[model samples]
Target: MYEIELLINGRPFRGAAEARTTLADFLRHTLRLTGTHLGCEHGVCGACTVLVDGVSARSCLMLAVQADGAIVETVEGLAEHDGTLHPLQQAFRDAHGLQCGFCTPGMLMTLVELLRETPHPSEDEVRDAISGNICRCTGYQSIVDATLAVAGAAGTEGSEP
Candidate 1:
């Protein structure tokens, strides 16, 4: 077993895992952070997406040891400590972007990266940013709308014309 340490969701975490263990398994099984889901396990479905060192990554495709000393962000980190939703999360709820919710975490993390880089992304950019994530339930329009809503709110906040 290899000992791994990561800064997860703004907190430090340490655990031991086999060298071959995927980061998804380490997060879910060892660290008990179940918000990162596993689907397909081949890095195609994107359900196991997470932010590593501030970039979106497929957790299932990353080994636990490979992520040692990296900073990681999961869906659980999106909300405020006092239970307040992040703007993107609130927008998703308002826009009804999620149905079954299996893919919401990945989508949220992916968009989090996108919004950080492009605070006010166009509809096409939002769609392109999330193109890697596959959501079987919402058909994607709602998701796109939700991202745009968040971007729109950001664009309008504290702006004077």
Candidate 2:
């Protein structure tokens, strides 16, 4: 087993897991951070997306040991201290961007990275950014709309997260 220490959602975690254990496994099985879903274990699907050092990554693609010294932000970390939803979360709700909600966590994480990298993204840009993520529910347009709403520029003015 390999020992790893990481800062996850603002908390420090230290544990011993198999060196080959996926970050997804460590998060969900060990830490119970179920918000990081496992869509396609091969990383084709972005369902396991999370913020690794502020960039969106498929947690399933990396071994838990690889996350040593990394800082991760999962969907569960996005809420306000008072339990209020972040603007993006509320926007998704208002725009009806989810169906079964399985993909919502990944979508939110991806959007957070998108907004951080480009506070204001064009529709095409949004689509391009999320191309790796697949939503079988196919609520894509509304997801885009909701993302735009969070950026506070649904009309192409570009918004930031």
Best by TM-score: 1
Q: For all the candidates, what are their Cα RMSDs to the real structure?
A: 2.3, 2.3
- Computed on alpha carbons, the lDDT of every model, listed in order, comes to 0.93, 0.88
Off by over 4 Å in 1: 158-161
Q: What is the per-residue lDDT of model 2 for residues 58-86, given as tens digits with 9 covering 90 to 100?
A: 99999999999999999999998899998
Q: Output the worst ten-in-a-row residue range by lDDT, candidate 2.
A: 152-161
Residue 23 lDDT, candidate 2, scale 0-100 = 95
TM-score, prediction 1: 0.96
lDDT of 1 by residue, 120-150 (tens): 8888898898888999999999999998888
The TM-score values for the models, in the order shown, are 0.96, 0.93
| Residue 110 in candidate 2, Cα distance off native in Å | 0.9
Point out the worst 10-residue segment of candidate 1 by lDDT. Answer: 152-161
Q: Which pairs, if any, clash in model 2?
A: 119-159, 151-159, 151-160
